[model samples]
Every structure is written in C-alpha cells, then in structure tokens.
Target: MVRSEWTKVWTTPGTAWLLITMVVATAGVSVLAAAVTGCPDTGCTVDVAKVNLTGVQLGQAVVAILAVLVVGGEYSSGMIRTTFAAVPRRLTVLAAKALIVTGVVVVTAAIAVAAALIISARLLPLSLGNGTVLRAAGGSVLYLGLIGLLALGVATAVRDPAAAVGAVLGLLYVFPIFGLATTDPDFQRHLQQIGPMAAGLAVQATTGLDTLPISPWRGLAVLAAWAAAALLAGGLLVRLRDA
Candidate 1:
C-alpha cells in the first residue's frame, strides 16, 4: 500500500512542483523578513528565531494544497474507485497516504526550514547551538508535517478538491482574523489557544514565553490534536461513505 501510494504521488508532476514551491516560498519569505527586522543594540526585543521563520505562514498554504490534492486528485480523476477495488480495506489506504504525506512533508519542511535558517542567520545573529533556537527550528518542521496531515484528513473527508482546499485554508488563516478583529483581550487569547495557526506557530517564539496564550510544546500539541481529530473524522467518513 505504501509503495503504491508513493508511486502515485511521485507520478504527478504537480506534486514535485508543489514541493519545490514550498521550499522556495518558505526560504524566500524568511529572508525578506530577516532583511526588514534588526537588533543592532543590546536588549533587543525581536524574536529572531520566529522572525526568520516567518515564511512558514505562507509555506503552510502550499503544504495544505499538496496534501489536499493527494487524495482529492484521485477522486476527481475517478481513480479512487480503482484504488478501492485494488485494496478492500479503506482505512489502510488512508494510513498509507498519511505516512507518505507525513514523510515527504517532513523532509521537504526540513530542507525549507534549514534554508530559511541558514539565509536568515546571515542577516541576524542566530545561535544554532542554543537549545531554544533548536527547539523552535525542529518544532517548525513538525508543525508543517502535522499541518499536512490535517489537510489530508480534510481532503479525504470532503472528497472534493476545491472544497477541501477552501476548508483547510479557511481553518488555518481565518481564525487569526477573528482573533485580531475582536476587542476583547481574553477572547483573543482564547482564540489563540484554540487556533491551529496561532497555537502551532507559538513554537517559533524564542522570547516572552510568559506572554503567550499557550506554551510552546503545548501549542504544538494543540495542533496535533486538531490533526488527529480531523484524521479520525476523515477515516470514519471514508469508511462509511461510498467512493
């Protein structure tokens, strides 16, 4: 199952292009962010780690689209029926896709994050040896992987390319808008605590830990929970519904 899914993914030229776009988009934005922010004096307030990795906000959109297309593409091409005919167990198919998507996203995100870090480091004094910086870098990679899983689950559940892409992007980008629009501080904090994008990105914070609505690792966990829920819902729906 895994091998077959891997082949299917690689055979699509768009998949390769999307992965390349993810790397470029992530690194490009990070470089631009590093260029605009500076801390020449002591006691600088900037979270350099987060600033350099800022491109992730855009990179995630591409990741979500790639993940959605993984499953949604098959459905659109009428190949899902053939897939099901080959493999009677629907859940296994999903599991294989989840594994492949996670692997590819992690590897791609690692490359993108590394490029961002390296290039951004040239602009800012980034200490790769620092424990906090290391955590932020590693966490960013995992964050992207979990996001891929979240999108895949959503795509599987909806079984529509356009709708799946819209739903996933809305879930990631819309909540922050709601948080920013409201006047209530407590409401804003609550939204951040529950929102996948806000919470997940919290891992990038290198300073002012006390001010965040959720802790770094805990914030990533919130995103992981969201991904798990989405996958569970998708798995159930895929099994119950006809392809």
Candidate 2:
C-alpha cells in the first residue's frame, strides 16, 4: 500500500508540475540574485550561498502546496476513504505519506540547492569551497524539506487543500512580516530570532557575525521546531479523527 501511494505521488500530474516549479524557482532566483548582487573586486562579502538559495523562500510555497495536496486533495475528492479502506490503519497511512513526501522533497531540494550554489559561485566573486557556503547550501535544502513535512502534517489535520495551503503559507511568512513591521529594535530582534524566515535564512549569513540577529544553525533549529510542532499536532489529530 505504501509503495502504491509512493507511485501515485510520483505519477500524479500536480506533483510533477510542483517538482518542476521547485527546480525552476530555486535556480532562477539564485541566478537573478547573483546577477544583481555581484561580488566586489576584493571578493564578495555577502553570503553567496544564501543569495543563491534566496529562491527557497518562494520555492517553499510550492512545496507547501505540493505537500498539502498529497493528502488534502484526496480528502477533497473523497479518495481518502478508499485509501483508508485499503490500508485500514490510519497511522500507517499517514506515516507512509509523510515518509514518501519528505524523501521526495528532500532529494529535490538538495539537488536544487546544490545546483544553485554551484552556479552562483561561478557567477559571483565568492568561492563555493568555503565552509560557510557549504553550510548555507546544505542547510537551505534541509530547511525546505522540513517545511514540506510541516505542510503535509498541517494538511492532514485540516483536510482541506485551500485552507491548509493558506495556513502553511501564513505560518511561514507571517512572522517574518510581523518582525519587519515592529518599530522596537529589541522586539524586532526577538521576532527575527524566532521567525522562521528571518531565523532560517540566518544560516546564509557569512558576514558581519557581530551584527547578525542570530547564529545560522540556531536559526535553522528554530524553523525545525516549528515544523516538528506542526507535524505533532497533525499527527495527534490524524490519530483522533475519522478518515
């Protein structure tokens, strides 16, 4: 049953389009950023990896939609009942979906991040061999994959694709906007530290450490916490609710 579900996901037209969108969006954004933000003659001071992967912010929305549709679409179409009938175990079905979705998204994200970083490194004045560049590129991929999982979980609980997509996008983007809206430096700093985008993007900061709002790894961790919490809530709801 799990294998069947995996095949269905890959063969689905929506999944195919979403995967293409992810790749195109990630690569295109990286190229545009590189072209617009060239490095200085003395070498770039900006985090090249981060700049290249900037598309992830937009790309993640597609991922969230893809994740939501995996299950939410089924619910909307009344196909979930057939799925439950075939599998007979709600937790197992959810686990299988989560694992398959995570695996696919992670692999796609990793490739996109790697290609973006490599292409940007060549176009920009920065070197890809730098440790910081590696961390940012790799972490961006992981961060995106986790975001997919979080969206999947949310979709499971909501059982509505439109609502799940809106909720996930709001969760991911709202905090960052709120942080920017605040006038207080201290409060803004705190919000940046906790906000998924502000914090997650910290991994891409390779310059001005003293001026940074938070450490890169710590920022990624904050995003991870959000993803984990969403997944947990979704899991609980899935276990408690009807198919």
Top-lDDT candidate index: 1
**C-alpha root-mean-square deviation, candidate 2:** 1.8
RMSD of each: 1.1, 1.8
Residue 163 C-alpha lDDT in model 2: 98
Clashes of 2: 0
TM-score for candidate 1, please give it. Answer: 0.98
Which sections of candidate 2 miss by over 4 Å?
Answer: 41-45
1-243, model 2: which lDDT tens digit per residue? 679779879876678889889988988888888888746555666666667777888889889999998999899989899988888778788889888888999999988887777776677756677887778778888888888888988998899999999999888888878877889899889988998778887887777767888998899899888888887888888778887
Per-residue CA lDDT of model 1 for 1-243, tens digit only, reads: 999999999997699999999999999999998887755454457999999999999999999999999999999999999999999999999999999999999999999999999998988768988999999999999999999999999999999999999999999988899988999999999999999999999999989999989999999999999999999999999999999
Which number leads on TM-score? 1
- The residue pairs in collision within model 1 are none
Q: What's the TM-score of every candidate structure? A: 0.98, 0.93
